[model samples]
Target: MQSMEGSNRTLVVTEFIFLGFSGVHRGQSFLFLLFLAIYLFTLVGNGVIFTLIQLDSRLHSPMYFFLSHLAFIDICYSSVTIPKILVNFLRQRHTISYNQCIAQMFFLMIFSATQCALLAAMAYDRYAAICQPLRYAHLMSRSVCVSLATASWTCGLLASTIHTVLSTNLAFCGANRIHHIFCDAPPLLQIACSDTYVNEMALHVASVFVSLGTFLLVVVSYIFILSAILRIRSNTGRHKAFSTCAAHLVVVIIYFGMANVNYNRPSAGYSLEVDTLISTLYCIIIPMLNPLIYSLRNKEVKEALRKVLGGLKKDSGLPQ
Candidate 1:
């Protein structure tokens, strides 16, 4: 956006160029193929899980309802960044229009924030099911689940709106090259021509609220969960209860660890390779790994997938 409404200086930056991996001296084609495969697999994996959840009535519980939304968010979240990454691999100079860059950043923020809150919600769900089994029914009823999900999404959107509004209003002057893979906030702020103190403040506040705050919620829930698990007199029962959250625990570790590394920084650093690698961890790798991670060791998900596959075979008149 360009503006000179009340100032003598002209601020013009209609688009930004991404130097994501353009500095890579070798094998752009290989990079493209690798990520393309990852992207397709990510979509197919999340899509299949999403469809299975929608079609299987057995999976209509509050937990699966949240799982469905998580799958949807993974699909959308990866789509927001991976496509641009793939495109950049084939072009000598990758560029995104001003409006497009802003839109990308907006969605990326929304999904990132929402996923943090959603993980907390899932943790709370697990806590209820395990620590308070007698009242789990009342604690995580349909209405209660809906309320939690709604609150997670509402907080995410509110936080993203505030950050995006603050970011786009900053003057970019003539600087338009983004060093990172995507239109992330830190990289964008690095090139701003105007004062960015207030914007940085808003970013830190939102990061604490969305990222650190939700992470603490998950941590506290897990503490209670661990205490409950330890109290079970039967060792097998204790192991079984802990196993239910094993997958979610793995995801929580990777997701929050990478998110903290990305957003908790004081400013954008100049190591392009390190930046791109970390970005890939959360944006592309985690989303692709989610469905398989959530389903591979889960008896319920495996059985549901088997039933769905069997139905498909019968519908197509293939051998039973």
Candidate 2:
């Protein structure tokens, strides 16, 4: 699709073509099946986690509260890109409307930014629980938890709004082919015919403020948490305290690591295949790993899962 600019008579793009899969001429079916399975797993995994947190009284706490938001974000984040990719695989022409691409980028930024804030919130929750047990209740009271969650979403909404509004104003009068797997800010900016100085600056500022800022918060929270853990004289106490934070730390490392690579890397000397792989890992695989990481590492979550499953079985009149 194309649109005419009034004075210059320039052809404006009404749709975008995805070139992420352009090099692949075969095994499209296999790729589709793999992504389909991953998407389904991401939904079920995050869904079960979200449901279990809501249903199980044992799982109700500030930590779990933040976790539920994370799970939901993961669901929304993967949904923004994966389904479109799936559909594109089935069609000969891999394309998305310009408006859809903008919307996709908007939601994608929202969820990713939200998850970063949520993870930092979770880290602070852990710090409160471990470093100040006596004050943990007051620190993470229901109201406080709600406020933190709300703030995280607000952060995402504000950041996404800035990027999306800026993105829509750019002129896509030349190539509309997005080089990356999805309609991300970087890929979209690369295709804009107009000067992207402001957009590029915004992206850089956001990378620092949103990504680096939240990451530093997590780091600072963990520093205090680790200090308190080390001061514990009892081996079991130290071990137990550390264990509470292990899964979150792992997730933070994986998330920030991939994000730094995906967004912060030098724009030069990167191949499309490399970019696609990193994006797939960052956007696609990370969400699926979150619930699994929590489930496998967390005894409470696993026990809750077992109980929930057992209850379902008992309700169905199956063997205990």
Candidate 3:
């Protein structure tokens, strides 16, 4: 089963074993059910948020616009790997094909990079709304929002293309055991039989640029936003202004906190268990909570949902 060209390595192994939560000594069944619940929440939460944003004209602004996009990416991101993991947990064996592995890694990188870009764009949106309230609409006009979203998707695709190309270039002739739930760049790179120096360099450079660049942009944007907020003399005015960004602030902290903890570590030194837990945060848990925190906590979305649900109920009664 030579999936790729010149892949005589298939003579050695047919499929690679995914050493998932199986490495955990005890509580395997408990962990499986835990992850299952998280996956379900992710689907419903993100799904509802996306639907609400699309249906509600009130959420057509850049902030909610980018948020809807984030929820979509998160839904795709979690689906790319979690369902397979859940299946493996059920069957007691975790293995993925060579082709499937590459596909998973590619999609993961694409969504991961896209999420970073979206978050950075959201920061800039808040900055404009708060610091340049006079020009909020002008700054985040329909054309401008479309441009930003396009750029985010383009950057994500380009980054994933680079990594996928580099990853597939390497040979895996030895033990085909991947010690992670999904086919991540790091673990797959480690398993390559050929020289991975180039791949590692690409990975490090991309990771550093995305992580640091996005972090810096978010911080700087918020700094200016805070400065603008503090300038308001009226306490009520200040409180009202801050309330608009409170949910965004929470999301930024949670997302970046876990990202920094997971990716900023030294590549050579890290525990597998620690990596697994961190992976759970950014991949499964964060995505599940994002839609809830952003939508359920906000008045606009709730009002819109109420109207839509009422309309739906009326239509259902009238029709049948």
Relative to the true structure, candidate 2 reaches a TM of 0.98
**For model 3, how does the per-residue alpha-carbon lDDT over 1-320 read when each residue is reduced to its tens digit?**
33444635244345678765767656767878898898889998888888988988888889989988999998999999888888777666678888888899899989988888888999999999989889989999999999999988888899899999998887786568876778878887767778999988887787777767887899999999899989999999999888888888898899888877765667673667777778888788899889778876789988888888889989889541
Clashing residue pairs for model 2: none
Instruction: Order the numbered candidates by lDDT, best leading.
Output: 2, 1, 3
Task: Identify the candidate with maximal lDDT.
Answer: 2
lDDT per model vs. reference: 0.88, 0.92, 0.83
Q: Show the lowest summed lDDT stretch of 10 residues, model 1.
A: 1-10
| Tens-digit lDDT track of model 1 for 253-288 | 999999988877556474888888888887999999
Better of 1 and 3 by TM-score: 1
Instruction: Indicate the worst ten consecutive residues by lDDT in candidate 3.
Output: 1-10
Off by over 4 Å in 3: 1-14, 24-28, 317-320
RMSD after Cα superposition, model 2 = 1.1
Q: What TM-score does prediction 3 earn?
A: 0.91
Per-prediction tally of clashes: 0, 0, 0
Superposed by TM-score, candidate 3 places the C-alpha of residue 129 at a distance from the truth, in angstroms, of 0.5
- Estimate the TM-score of every prediction: 0.96, 0.98, 0.91
Model 2 lDDT tens row, 1-320 = 56676877788788899888988879799999999999999999999999999999999989999999999999999999999999999998889988899999999999989989999999999989998899999999999999999999999999999999999989877688888878989888877889999998998999999999999999999899989998999999999999998999999999999999988878562788998999999999999999899999899999999999999999999998
